[model samples]
Target: MLVPLVIGMSAPSGLEGGELAAVVARGELVWAADQEGGGPHVFPDPDAPQRLTGFEVELAELIAAELGVKARFQQGQWDRLPLLLGHPADCVINGIELLPERRRDYHCSRPYFAYGLQLIARRDGPLDTVETLTAPGPAGRWRVGVLTGSAAELFLRSHPELEVDAIGYDGTIDSLEQVKSGVLDAALMDDCIFNFYADRFAGLRAVGRPFGGGYYTVLTARDTPRLSTAIDEALGRIIADGRLKTLYDRWDLGGRQQILALRDAAEIPVATRRSLRELAIETLPLLLSAAGMTVLLACLSFPLAIFAGLGVALGRLYGPAWLRPLLTGFVEVVRGTPLMLQLYAIFFLLPKVGLALPALVAAVAGLALNYAAYESEIYRAGLKAVPLGQFEAAVALGMTKWQALRHVVVPQAVRLVMPPVTNDFIALFKDTSVCSVITVIELTKRYSVLALSTGRIVELAVITAILYLAMSWPLSLLSRRFETGQEQRP
Candidate 1:
């Protein structure tokens, strides 16, 4: 019997368990991303509760049914889904495009659906067609908003004079709203998505025709060859037997047929395929460049965190009774919440409250604030670890409370906290990847951009990991040395 496998569902309309009955019988399981409210590629219909109804869901259900497995659903962020592939889910069934770079890390199922890049403009805008929008003049130079890390943004970036105002939104609907509110002149998005929202907004319209034919494929982990083959065959069968066509008709995706045909012929051209040596050489500079940014961010943020943590620790340990509670609550709140959400709040929400900050500055501030909260706890523990007799002895020697803390308490506390601080620094370095969501091109962000460009996520991610290890190993060694020296001095 086949081992039970989990397949991811991208949206509610795409696929579901009813189609995966065959796969369930064979001991396979279908797991769908809980995109209840819609994300970048998936949109939730208000009519449905905690379920999606897109092309991704329908196709995934069909695949699971064919494999005779039961289908299950779970929710995860779009960016986080890649990390979840081998763990919580066997394959991500979103309408993922099969790009050359992506093939390095994932095995993509045959193309089952297609969409194209389209321009969305406000109803009151003078620009309505692609020709008029791109025509040579100031009026034609409208700012086009796109989601960061998406193909649309990358494509726009390649054009120097396009006046792109790329925004990194957690969801496509949010990006669309920016355009609707006139915060952005226009938005470049998938045609299918534009159609879904255009009806509701009334002010938005798809400009010109769709371009850059894109197709959807199931993304499986690279190591799962057998599973990959099974998926491809199942998809091929669906297409050959006309079930795929019927599903598309039912979903009104017939307009995407030409793009699907183009996707069927897709493959990485030989000229673009680099050998291992070439790939390494090409990726080295990028990795190095991003590493420098990561180091810079960490260096700038660490000192701030340490200082803030020290202040918070002192306040909690020695402040007036009323103030102590406030400081303690502040530290606890920051520590309890996710660092990513905090960063998002700072980058996206803060600007609206008239506290705008540059992306890099916001990232550094968020990282520093997050680490400071944890570090305060660490410092407080370190402070307590110092014996009370030491302070008493300082007092006997005629030292004041402030002097005792500065001279006697702090030195010992530093030694006690040094190891944990070093460990925290290493973690902070890795956590810096979250800043990429706000457009800070740190080490991980650079790798992700390269991965999207080359479609080689596994190799690139591995290389990035190794680089991180190399950078952090020395810090680990230094922490050990500090511990040894502290022991010898005492």
Candidate 2:
């Protein structure tokens, strides 16, 4: 059997120096994912690809370099990483907590970094500190926004008596936006994240002190001991030599000394980290569920496109001349516009026009309609490619026009169109990422969400791209088979 691949290492934050060095020395490659807006692990750097750069990137590269391997990165939305584990990456980096439930499924590295939640509020807001918000009666009802899947979010969820209105946003920037716009009275995030935003977003400040110590550990496959050991050693070395601190300073995270101090104090025992294999195991099921949606959408939409394209082709080719223009116009409009725009219009805008559809239906409809237009052209070309001599031959044989066209013209036309039509479906499958914007929750959307949550953009994106390739590769084989069959036809 092939040696099981060592795929990912979920870090506490985005790639910083240590993680990158570890991967480099071990000759292990890594894929990094990041949030849509900068998360503690991931951030938007104008110079980076897809506008993402952060601790995750630096650490992932360092680890990869230490391993003598390559480091790649990706961008995704938060709240989706757990669902993307195993399918797209080996594990995510960033201080992922080792919960009892998660421990059963995932193996975790020794704690590398630690931090705590910080409450932030606008300069002119009502509450300045966590204590005031926790103080007396009605004031406790003040809304607090927290990025979903963060430690702060989990803390808020566990304490219902606090009476804080908890809103789960996908990114720190979004949570900050709610606070800045006065939509939320305050927001809670990691101290490093709060500091990053407080400086970038004017009129916002970190209030009171940080709360609840949390350690950051690398999450990986529960069964992969060799991979886990390699990464742990790399991380340990990086921490010992002060490379990790260099990264902290580079990102201006050195200012959060207290946060780092807490991490050092609460370090989880090495034996405990080793015992946490179960945490990584459950991750696969969740990721597979999301991957299933991706496959389902692609499969369902493709057949619909074939039928819709055929109908459209018939209309354009055989319908009345006046009707042809209308059919042609419809195809043109769909083909001309971006599929992403179509998905949004169908999912978000169409509901306003009294035509509401579920997110999945809208996604399927948008993809099918978009591909049908391209398919129609392929079909039309196929029809036109049928020689006039075939019709003449049919007439000479005393066959009816309908019978001749159906038996002779269509079969050949279908054979001719098969390749291009197949190509269109492959393209459509990849393009399904656009549906993620409207919450269709397909592969791309899942990857995007996972990236945002874990700040491992490169890894998530690579897995997503691979998933697309896996789907397309089979379709390509089928297309080639059809082409071979066509050639063999008597």
Candidate 3:
């Protein structure tokens, strides 16, 4: 989802030091946001699918114009924005709140917007207020959904006595949909977001006073102090020129943002200090839990792929004439389409027909089916590489046709196939990260969540990369051992 700037029009400036200057030099100020968060902050414009239009989008544009550069937008998962800074984007402006920990990790601009949490519930639902369902009875049982890494979740998590069964999701629309459909008792998110959906969903209504939120600031990397300063100054000018207020009015972010912008109340959050060893010790357990899922994905699906692939390969090569073409078509179809589409089909699309599967089952099934196509090719090559004389020799020795293949050809072909098989197996380890789309919390997804939740993107990513290496290295060693043993075989 990292949409890079593709406009061919280039303008080059020769300035130095700051990210702002660098962006100006390149003729584009690349801003990153995750559209999944949705609504008045940043989402795709319905009338124009390819364009983004929100207060934050407009805010980025004004600042870019202030620095005399074009605004380029890139999309990354919301939890991964901090990681994308300085890599794919010069800064991020997706209504990132002015949290204490965020200020510590990133070179954040002064607050441009201020808002609070809005508790949203079904209009006809029994829950009317936060205190309404807090009574001591069966009716007090409430299942609330919150965006996984938001302050709403943090607030709810701090109060276990509330006995709220909290559900975490990555997007706003899903939680709202769940609330509307009675799947969730209520949903909590930003007031600005609630405003975007207020008129759109007649069944959903925002209730209770908006509470417990702070200013939203733009984030740049800590290394880019010069760029940070430029952002601060540009934002100041935008406020003074009334452009900031115009955006707030246009986007319905309430008049409170204008007051906060004019008042300029920005405090840097204190940074946490820890040794490398301390950091590693803190993060390893969480990473390890996620790594276990990744390993499970590879381990569960791979042998199935091997067995299915070998069967298909044999059928294609030596089955009845009518079956050969069918097996060949199966290989072509599976290989031709993307693995992502296959996952969506199994997990998202199939449920319409009542074949609903759990996330893990869908992920394993999708991976097995996808890999079987490639594995069949590897197997077919190995089968063909077996000299015909070997089969002839076995058949001449009173072995049945199936017996010759099972005992002689397959055993030899498997040896030749082992090296590539092991290599694919290792590659499949990393590929399991994509299973996050199906809600399987593999290593990479865990890293994103932990990184955002704890504001330790760099530390978590280093540990995660090591975990991935740890998963694949053993397979590499095993493959090398097989290769050496194969070479030593005669």
Candidate 4:
């Protein structure tokens, strides 16, 4: 889930020479955050999508000014924001909960924003409180949604006795929408986020007093201790001067939970790291399950893409001339766009027109459509490569044009394209990672979550890569066998 970004950025102003001196030289504090679907933390202004606004935005600016530098925002996925530290980002100012696991991996500043888990339910729903939710329910368990890789998810999963199904969504607002539509019985998110978005989602009400308190802390690379110290001091100054409170009040984040921000830095608990063997033992099953998802997504989509692409290829080559332009245009459009955008459109945009697809279905459909464009090109080439003699020979045997295509040309084309088609299947396995943005938890997303929580990036990543190889190796060998067979055949 960690996207590549350039590194070698300087740290903040307080540091003298070495890597820490870059911020003073550039006079910019490059902070990483995810503005997309990141409400109340950092999100685009509704009036002007290009402009970013949020309490965290102001907090970043405040810290930047305190460091005597300008703040520049770097956009990244929320779950992968920490990975930007020390590279493209001087620090991360998104709502990164100061969990013990994250603190164990990265340098964490003192708390700047206090928060807690807030449960949201339909205003007229029978479930009234967390206590009520914990009580024995009907035959079906209540489906409660939380943002994937969020502290809310951790808190919810920690208590199996709660007896609710914890569904993960890519965004807090997405979960709220599910609640509003009755797709979910309830949702849990940061209290600050709930406060910020409450008016936007009118049908939902807070189900109980906020629980499972935590604080949002700034994170920097472990090597940037000076920058981390400066950030901590800046946060302390912001809190002591009442500026933090004023910012919170402006954002409606002022509440009793805000007191959590006042704890001494030493009060933060130190997290213990587990050995790699222990971590592997614990996470292997989850990774295997996620790998199963990766396999399922690719297996389900590639066949569909193959069939659809073949149909498109045939239509362009042999069907009505009028249909050719439309099919060609489809190939152009789908090939021109990113698969992520296609999935986003299917999962998010389609919901507006009353065509909301379940996450897995949307993911499969998006991957199928996106790859079908490339598959069409491959098939088109394969069909074109067939010699004119093949069609003529079939026609000389009294076969119709359709019969000639079905009996002779297309089969040869499929054989010609089989290797490339298998190659695409391998590629589609990797592309399944993009489906994570739609809340489809596959291998890569699972690796990211486990790596973040367990601080075992390389170990989990190697396992994930091996799982991918294991899945694709058989196909690769099959493709080679087919190549050898064709080479031997005439």
- The best candidate by TM-score is 4
TM-score of 4: 0.90
* Best of the candidates, lDDT: 4
lDDT per residue as tens, model 4, 1-490:
3322112223332333344567867899999988864778899998999999998899999999998999999998777777677677889998888888888898888877777799999998888879977776554788888887788889888998887887777778878877786667899888878878888989899988989877788998877777778888998898878788788777777633474445533467779999888998999999999999999999999999999999999999998999999999999999998999899889877877778787899999999999999999999999999999999999999999999999999999999998888888888988999998877889888888887788777667778778888998998998898888889989
TM-score for each predicted model, relative to the true structure: 0.73, 0.52, 0.78, 0.90
User: Lowest summed-lDDT stretch of 10 residues in model 3?
Assistant: 1-10
> With candidate 1 superimposed using the best TM-score fit, by how many Å does residue 487's alpha carbon deviate from the native?
1.4
- Model 1 poorest 10 in a row by lDDT: 1-10
lDDT of 1 by residue, 1-490 (tens): 0011112222222132232333344476545353622533355656885556666567777777766664555566554455456555667776566666556656777766676889888778776777665454354456676655565766676666554545444456656665676555778876777766676778788778988756667877665566667778878887877777787676666734734584467564322567778878988897998899899889999999998998899889987799899998999899889998999788767755667676789989999999999999999999899999999999899999888998999889988899889999988988988887665777876775675566555677678878898889999998898888878886
Please give the lDDT score for candidate 4.
Answer: 0.84
lDDT by residue (tens digit), candidate 2, 1-490? 0011113333332233354344446455645365564755776676764566778778877765655676665444445454344445545675465444345446677666667788998897777667776654244477787765667877887787676866655557756765675656788887877776666778888888888857666776554456666777877787767788888778777725733563456434333322223423523354567778877888899899888887789788887799899989999899889897888678656655667665679889988998888888888899889998997898789998767878888788888989788887777777776776655556655554444444445544555566667778999999999889888976
Predicted structure 1, TM vs. truth: 0.73
lDDT of 1: 0.71
Q: After superposition, how far is residue 92 of candidate 3 from its true place, in Å?
A: 1.3
- Which scores higher on lDDT, 1 or 2? 1
Off by over 4 Å in 4: 1-20, 124-127, 131-139, 181-183, 255-266
Between prediction 2 and prediction 3, which has the larger TM-score? 3
Q: Distance (Å) between predicted and true CA of 162, model 4? A: 3.4
Candidate 1 deviates by what RMSD? 6.8
